[model samples]
Target chain A: MCTYETSHVAVEGAGKGADGWFPVTEATVYFDHPVAAMAEHTLNLDFLNRARGASARVAVELDATSAYALAQAILERLEAAPPALTGELHRR
Target chain B: MRAMDEAMRAETVKFAGHGGDEIEGYLGQPLGGGPYGAVVVIHHMPGYDRESKEHVRRLAAAGFLALCPNLHVREAPGASPDDAAAAARAAGGVPDDRLVGDVAGAIAHLTALPSASGKVGTIGYCSGGRQSFLAACSLPLDAAVDCYGAFVVEAPPPERGLRMTPLLERAGDLSCPLLGLFGADDQFPAPAETARLGAELTRLGKAHELHTYEGAGHAFFSVDRPAYRVEAAVDGWRRVLAFFGEHLG
Candidate 1:
C-alpha cells in the first residue's frame, strides 16, 4: 500500500494555442515512504479534481524525484547569482 | 498638478508610417503631464486585448507616455479562438513577420508624439518579450524588458524553423541593456536556456540580467491569469521601472 503526501499547489498562466488563454495549476505529491516512492506511481486524482475551477486545466503527475531535483538546481543557481539589489525594501 | 486628481486618459490613435501603412494603437498619458519619457509596449501572442490596455494604463500611471500597437489590426481585435485558428491555418501555420515591423512603426510613432521625449524603451510579455529583444537588435532603444519570452534558443533547421530561435541568435547583436524575467517552471524556455543566454550575453559584452522566480510558472506577470504571482509580478515591474529610469533617463 502506497501513501501520498500532498505538498504545494501552484496556479500559473499558460500559453493557449487557440483556446485564447487559460490557467494551469499543479499540485506536488510526495511519497510517504521509500517503498511507496519506488512502487507504482501515485495517482493523484484528488489533486486533479481540486484543480478544476473556473476556466481551469489540471496536469497531474508523480515526479517525486525530478521535481526535487529541479528545486535543488534552482536553489543552487540562486546561491551562485548573489542578489544584486540589497536593501530592506528590495529584500523578499 | 495633484497626484490623485490627475486623471488617466486613453485613446485609440493611428499613425501613417514611412511604409505608407496606417498603424493603430492605444495611447495612454497622464492628464497633467507636460512631457514624459516614451515607452512602446508590445503585446504577447493574444494581441492587444483588454489585458494589454490595462497594462498600458499602469505604465501611464508610472509617468510614461505609453503606446500599445495592435499588431493584428487586420484581424478582429476580439476574434474568437476558432477564427484565429482558422486564420493561422490559412497562413500555413507561419507566424506573422509584420509584427516586428509594427513594433518599429510604434517606436517611430512614439518618437514623433508631442508629449513624448525622444528617449524611448520597450516592455513586452511572453511573445512580446521576444519581440522586445528583437526591437533592441534592429532598432535604437534605450532599454528593453522581456517577461518570460523565449528570446534565446537554438534555431532549428530551415525545414522546421522553431517558433523562437531567431530572437536567440540575435541576442548577441543587442546594443542596449536587456532585462529578462522568467518563471522557474516554464517548460518552453527552461532555466538551462536562460543560463545559456546569460553566458552568450556575457561573451558579447552586453549588459543583461536574468531573474527567475521560484515556485512561479509562465506568464506570472499577467494579473488576469491564474499564473499571476503577486510578489514576483510586483518585483518584476519594479525592476523594469528601475531599468528604464537608469537607461532612458
Candidate 2:
C-alpha cells in the first residue's frame, strides 16, 4: 500500500545524475516503495532540477534506521563545524 | 496450460486515452486465435516498468488479451518508467477522471480486437488496485481484481498531499463482480480494513469475494521486490485466474 505522502523542499546544491552533474533546485522526501531498494518501503529522496528534465534526478532509498543515523550525522557535523565554515555567522 | 515464450505477442502501442490524448501503451496478446476475454492491467505507482509489462504478457498467456496504458505518459513522455512515475507523483498523482478515461479507452481497444469477446475485466496492484475498483464503479466491467490497494475505503491523512479520495461511497455503483486480494500483514489496508470493506459490499449485496493471505504484506505479488511472498503470490494468482475464469470467461 502506498502512503502517497511527499515532502518537498527547495534546495541549493548540485546532484550527479545519469547525464552527469546538474543543479538541484528541488528535493522531495517520501516513504514509499523504492524503485531499486530491496525493502518493501524506504525513505526515498529525490534531488531534481525540473528545468533540466525528469531524468536529471538523483534518488536515494534509505531504511528508517539508516535515515535516522544520516539525519543525526548531518546535524552533528553542521554543529561541530566552525560558524565561519557553515556561514551561520561571522567569526570575530 | 504452459505457453511457450514465443506464443505471445507484446509491444508498445499508441492509443487515444483520456480526452483523446495520444498515450503510449503496452499490448500483449496470445497468438492463440479465439474470442478471448480481455483485461486491463493497471500499473502501480512505481511506474509502467517491465514487471507491469510481464503482467500484461502473463494474462495474454492465460489466454486473455491484456493492455496497460502508460499512466505517466502525460507527465513525462519518453522518460524512464521510474522517472515518469516520480514526476507524476510529484505533480500530485493521476486524476481519477483521467484514470477512468484511459481505462475506458483500453476497454474500447480490447472490444475492437477481432478475437475479443467484448467481455473485459480489470486487475491492478497497489495504487492500481484501488483504481481497478474505481474503474469498475465508473464503467460497466465484467470483473475486477484489486490486489492490496489502499485508500479505497479511507482517505489519506489530509497532509499527505495526494489527489485522491475514498471510493467506498461508490460501492453501490459497482457494475461488476469483484475479486479482492489482500495481505494480512499490510497496514495501509490492514486486515481490519479489508473486513470492513467486505462487510460494506455484502450489505450492499454487491458481488465480491475477498481473500487475505497471512504472512504476506503489501506488494507480495511483486516478484522483484523483497515484499514478494512466494506462497501468497502463487495462491493469489491461482485464485485470480479462477475468478476471471468464472466471471470474464
Pick the lDDT winner. Answer: 2
Q: For residues B142-212, could you state the per-residue lDDT of candidate 2 as single tens digits? A: 99999999988988778665778999999999999999999989998888888989999999999999999
lDDT of each: 0.64, 0.89
DockQ of each: 0.02, 0.68
Off by over 4 Å in 2: A88-92, B1-6
The RMSD of every model to the true structure, in order and in angstroms, is 16.4, 2.3
Q: Which docking category, incorrect, acceptable, medium or high, applies to candidate 2?
A: medium
Error of 1 at A63 (Å): 20
Q: Which ten residues in a row have the lowest lDDT in candidate 1 chain A?
A: A45-54
Query: Candidate 1 on B1-249: residue-level lDDT in tens?
Result: 122554678888897532557867888876664466778898765456678888888877777778998765544334432233222222322243566677777778877767676888888887677778777887878888888776346443455323435566777678689899988987546788778878889888899988999987777876665567898999988998788767765
Model 1 chain B TM at 0.87
For model 2, name the residue pairs that clash: none
